[model samples]
Target chain A: MDAAAHDTHDAHDEPHLTPYSVYVGIWLALIALTGVTVLASVVDMKHQAIFVALFVATAKSTLVVLYFMHIAFENRVFWWFLLSAIATFVIFVLLTFADYAYR
Target chain B: MSSDTAMPDLPETNYINAEKGLKSWLTTIDHKRIALMYLIAIGGFFVVAMGLGFMMRLELLNPGEQFLDGAAYNRVLTLHGVIMIFLFIIPSIPAVFGNFCLPIMLGANDVSFPRLNLASWYFYIAGAIVALFSVAAGGVDTGWTFYVPYSANTDANVMLPMFAAFLLGWSSILTGLNFIVTTHRLRAPGMGWRQMPLFVWGIYATSWIAVLATPVIGITLVLVLIERYMGIGIFNATMGGDPILFQHLFWIYSHPAVYVMVLPAMAVVSEIVPVFSQKRIFGYRFIAMSSIAIAAIGSLVWAHHMFTSGMADEGRIIFSFLTFFVSVPSAVKVFNWLATMYKGSIKVDPPMLFAFAFIFLFSIGGFTGLLQGALSVDIHLHDTAFIVAHFHYTMFGGTGVMFFGAMYYWWPKMFGRMYNRTMAYVGFAMFFVGFNTLYFPLFIAGLKGMPRRYADYLPEYHSYHALSTVGSWIMVTGILILFANLIWAIKRGKRAERNPWGGATLEWAVASPPATHQFDGPPEVGEPYDYKIPHLGDDESAGSGADEGKA
Candidate 1:
């Protein structure tokens, strides 16, 4: 495979490289989310503060993963992989919160 | 320990003898050698942990302070759980047998990432050292669960063992990643997912659990560490944390971790059943899908362990339902194995006997598990000897029994030697009797309300304890004999034929113990369980799994 990829020099054989502009855009989005996070912290949302902070953090990470980290151009296999992992984390948080909610 | 050379002129140049010296072993990227390294390390941990269990059983024999003080007993119990669980059982089948067999079965030279495979072995060793260090450093008494306020504030060296678990989780995650990728990328060109052996499917499912679920424990343990060292109060109740939340986080990983311990044993049984029965595996696809189903459903049921930890009733009901659902796939597997054996020319070898034992023992483990999964029943049986007996039935009786079974099943293929068959039977007879005697009494005792993790018991539980302790001695004697026989076979046993079992898998097509490079080049892929391939089923005591290139 290595030899074929090297010798073919075909465009299809090349890895899907994320454009520089896309990474810069992701970086800017991340900075904007961070600014929002900081601003949100200044005002107390009481029960909503943790949720608000988590949402912004998740948004920043998703952008970084999809664009800056190049999962955007990767195979659908990886997309499902990322989704399942996130789902597992969500189920964990949701179920643990079940105890809190009921109590 | 008779070795009447099954194949006297066995090849001198296989994986074990191909490499020499400790340095070669340490640096080698060969998965088979890495497997042997894990076997020796894990085998030692098993014996040590088994001995700790024996001590616990002995202490329970007559009640009040027989030998170990209560504090000492707590430490011993912790060591037994920590060593057996985190160190021994989790890695036993997958790390040892899966490593030795998976790639070869797939007709590949090695796992997708050979270097990472070796690195996983090193990680395992590093974790093991810290675990042993914890034992030496006055041991941890927080029990294996390492729950709240006590685990948070205890001065007993909790840090090292937690650190060990964290490192071992990395080892597990990496190994699982390697297997997943290997199964995806490295299977021989002709071998489709459907054509792959059921054992591969088992490991494939287990690897995902290892990869996805292990880090939950890593994070949970890190939280505990932070709470302990920094006193940030993530879990210690007095310090403004939630202990029940801690249970949630801990079991989120630990429960699925149970599947990590047993799925590979099921996988081994999948392989052993059809081969010994001399029949095509009935419902191969169902068996394969059940492995996946178990992994997926198994992950969701983690909170079942927390049924009594003040979890919401809704969560308990949901988890309980998922727990019952997970049992369906396992029952499906058992049913299929039975179906495969029905009216087949069943030959009883040591491996087959273990498979038979696995079905029976794991059934006990599974049914008992169902009883606990019921919300109402679990409330009654939460931390009794019943839970202890239940897990041991699955883990030891199920996985541990199959671990030896896998040893016998793959003995010729892995080591190029066959142990004394009669001796194996003798050993297993004691093992079966001792295993039953040891744990069945615990079930009765548990029903009568004996608590687990206690050094002493009430006089009412005395007879049960007495019977169980004696059972442990018998069980250990048998286990030791089994181990000794295998060890004796390595040096003096008769040479084994390449395909001694007439297995249809690619591993049997290679020389016993397999060459450093397993296949000459993508040798034949078969219907993995199909016995109808010519000469493949010839073995009523079949030999020569040499390929006809039949699919």
Candidate 2:
């Protein structure tokens, strides 16, 4: 509770810099995920194809949030904030499916 | 703490007079200025929405259509809900009071993203225009939820209002993001998380709900629009989509939205209850943590709304259980508030009166909600007048009542003028009585099986409807007096003291109506509710010689 406890924030005076190559790498992964999504749609996995496409889209978004949004370089509290959003989403999806699955 | 001299009669340059014209207000990034702008916008919409409610009550006076026909009544109902929920209640406490007070309470000059704060106001205005324009271009009749199948079929201008709801969600998300950053970044030097004010905690939890839950509804509305526009059939049963999915998505965002509406009001109670009682809060951490518990637990109970929509028993029971569980945190709050008042020096001032009213009324609302949460009871009261009555008890009785309370509590500090406390008490009395008279009857009628959303009721229900209509007249008269008294006090009331309420928080430390910059030095952080000894002392920075605990 002292001022010293807050004196050491992870977000210091200097910005956490990411190299250009890391951005290039994330861009390549995004392109590969897009191809996977399109390919999954054309293939006849039927019901699971939607899941496959969704899975790929989720990966793309994770990459964007962690890197493009710089959450990877941010403080621990930032992760807690992200986790809360994910928790809300997971609760909604799971509970919603509980109804649909039971039906 | 030095208390030799009293502070100045009034600050020569406060936020209000610091600048001089229309454009300064229009273009300003100051959180206080933005809050005032939101107050005007939200207040204007509230009156229009109230007028819509008045018309509905007028139409329902004797049943069988007083003036509005069945179709017209449907349109009027939809408009009222749309304006009240989207344009009014959703942003009422947070955007206005939260904006004006949070940064100062945290000992910062402004919100973290001041420009974004201004943008949220503009977004509110834009969405409001679209909603009002929808009314002119042949109003929507989907009844605020915009339930599908029928929503897709309705020829009413659903698209425009739906678009407006989407834009309002953006406004909410941006505001939430701004608040989260502010809370993380801007606490005064020594204040820790536990030492922060309960109002800040309330707003913090609400902001997360806004950020996380709103996007689902935004996309859900968009899908419906696309379904209607392009025959996408996502929610249209004939087109191989599930209408229940639409319900799932709608309430998923909406049920938490109920908390988005009420949590800040609860936070306001946590604040005023202690100051008026002349005691420190009973259990600060418990109250602070319960706000989050309510937010998280409240999010999971969305399916209770869908229980009678023909969902399976497993989902029904689970949602029912969650619904019952959510009330625990709220009950924790109510009990904590009661305990805070015990053996303390209690002042039945207007704000405390409103706080008392909030506890009594919201508890009734909460218990009734638990009644409906029981799967068996819900099967009977699913869409009855009881549901309508329960919602108002919580939203109107809880949030709307506290809105006036906040106006009374902070009026002097915000406007640099003290209102006539006697008139305020009179207004609160009429409002409380008229309020109970108006909505309390519908609970009985609902129990007696009068249906909701209908233009006519059975002859047996006539007495209930009549009494309720008369109650609306009483309530609106009380509301008129309440607003008139406050509005008149802006220029004419007594010049207020900087610390009239002896609050332990930071907002009272500066000049009444406060300077454009809040603190002249690092605000000394203490436990927010502590009132045993003086919480603050005379520093030129703290409006020289204005000491807390003087009252």
**Stretches > 4 Å off in candidate 1:** A1-9, B1-8, B535-551
Badly placed stretches (over 4 Å) of model 2 are A1-21, B1-8, B533-551
iRMS per model in Å: 1.5, 0.7
* Deviation from native of the Cα of residue B421 in model 2, angstroms: 1.6
Among the candidates, what TM-score does chain A have in each? 0.78, 0.85
For model 2, how many clashes?
Answer: 0
DockQ, candidate 2, comes to 0.75
RMSD to true structure for each model, in Å: 3.0, 3.5
Name the TM-score of chain A in model 1.
0.78
B1-551: candidate 1 lDDT, tens digit per residue: 12353344656577888878999999999899999999999999999999999989888889799899999999999999999998999999999999999998888889999999999999999999999999889899999899987898788989999999999999999999999999999999889999999999999999999989999899999999998888798887788889987888888888888899999999999999999888999999999999999998888887888888887787777788888999999999999999999998898989999999999999999999999999999988999999999999988998899999999999988887888899999999999999999999999998889998888878999999999999999999999999999999998777766567768887776766666876656677778877766644332232222222222
- CAPRI quality of model 2: medium
